[model samples]
Target chain A: MKKEWPLWEVFIRSQHGLAHKHVGSLHASDAEMAINHARDVYTRRNEGVSIWVVRSADVVASSPDEKAPLFEPANSKVYRHPTFFPMPEEIKHI
Target chain B: MSNDTVQYLLRLGDNALILSHRLSEWCGKGPALEEDMALANTALDLLGQARLWLSYAGELEDAGRDEDALAYRRNDRQFCNLLLVERPNGSYADTMVRQFFFDAWHHLALQGLCRSADERIAGIAAKAIKEVEYHLRRSSDLVVRLGDGTAQSQKMMQRAVDELWTYTGEMFESDGVDEQAVVAGIGFDPVALREPWLSYVREVLSEATLRIPPADAFMQKGGKQGRHTEALSYLLGEMQYLQRAYPGAQW
Candidate 1:
């Protein structure tokens, strides 16, 4: 029987201002190899400057069923948006 | 174009082309999915480098031949790659050890070739060296990890390294064409690459807790002289199948 390596979620930092955005997941034997695999798989075209890899097991994810209760409240809370507070045109670039 | 130049470039192109073809055999057979991607990626890089070198060889020869004609049409005896590149990929451990040796040699060789008095050769070497560097890192890292990781892995790696040691001698072999190419400023001497390659291989093996095979091991030669083992013709049969079956066919 073939034994499988552990899964890692890959995060790639494209440029200075960008965060380490999750690109995809892959299997590797360890953290170091996971990062190496991430570099080869996710950044083959020089698409990233840095990478971060975490074992998929380490992540705590919210359940999909709770999306409406968790996020729908923000959709209706228009007062929370800064644009909802009108300002005079004198404040350009704000 | 001097025939010496054609001969020199054929060695480089054939090494890359044949190794790429070997790695392509691992397409869906890799032990893991990510490893599959890594091997395929390295194969693509070598294939691209092969195209450049073979295409330039065609240009230098000034014959009607092009890259496709040179790569697919040439028979086994006409190929002049280093012997190390053509040995069968025995196992994952053996494959990585083979890659480690070739990667070290290729990386240093390209760094020297980057200074070629010929502009096109230097330019291609400069670009290809980056890919070779990455290949070296990946292979050496695996060599160290697996060599030190477990008893089974270490045993497997040691067996592979010992088996491949004899073939390493051909990488440093030189002849009249090698001398002329270096004198013509279009090629670098492979003998000069030997010490650095040894250092790199030794250091990595040390870190991996593996010992280098004894230097007195019986050495083999002749791949660079258009002489090859029986494995090469079989490789060509698969690689050249399309061009052989469909005359002048294009994808």
Candidate 2:
């Protein structure tokens, strides 16, 4: 059997005041190397300020193909959003 | 023609060019695919920096040559890079140690270059220093983590450091270009750069739980005048192949 590191999924915040979004995955010997690998791979363009790499197996992601039932149902609940309560035109704070 | 300025620029350009060649060798052979891409990217940055510096040097000399002409056409005897950069990438440990050493030196050099009187050189320095600063930080972080982390890593890091430490001296010692640039306020005396560099390196090494190689031994020298090691020839053959073959051909 070939010896190799487990895969890791990397997420990064491109800048301050931004959300951490999935970037890419890399293989590394351990957590530290995973983070280093992510920095080198995903952040070279100065595209990110923060990086988070987790073991690929540790991530629990919802299947993208099931999005209609998993997410569209929530979107159809009009009561879940506050758009119906819109009133004052002068209310600057949305 | 200011011989000192020409020499100074060649030193800077040669350092970047040779190191870029070395780094490019990691394109397919890095420990991981991510590292491979990262190294290749960094190599591009270095090669770009070299082109700018070499072109600038050519202009200052009023020479009809361009960057490619200087980079590919120059004989080994005309190159002036330090020996540390020309050594082969022996292992992951070896490459990292070589990078760590050069990054530290480059940070100091760039810091000085940013203040150069030549506006163009200063601008190039300003642009490149930011990237190089990050390179230094990342390399230093890896050194700390690996040196202090596992027995295998620690042993390899230590061995690499010990083997590479001998070449660290020539980096700070001035030849002729050093003096000229210093006088022109476009240069730094590498001797003056040594103390701060040592302190910075010591702090990082200490935090990494790595001991400084003893100062008792004599230092290796001769890269400034192009007395490169055996590895440089092979590296040059690969790097200069296309340019040397096509003499003046360009896209």
DockQ of each: 0.75, 0.57
lDDT of 1 by residue, B162-188 (tens): 999999988888899889988898888
Q: Report how far off residue B239 is in candidate 2 (Å).
A: 1.2
Give per-model CA RMSD.
2.6, 4.1
lDDT of 2 by residue, B3-40 (tens): 78988999999999999999998889887687788788
Cα lDDT, model 1, residue B162: 91
Runs of candidate 2 with Cα error greater than 4 angstroms are: A1-7, A13-19, A28-36, A45-58, A62-94
In model 2, what lDDT does residue B234 have?
A: 79
Best by lDDT: 1
lDDT of 2 at B83: 91
Candidate 1 residue runs with Cα over 4 Å from true position: A62-76, A85-94
Docking class of 1: medium
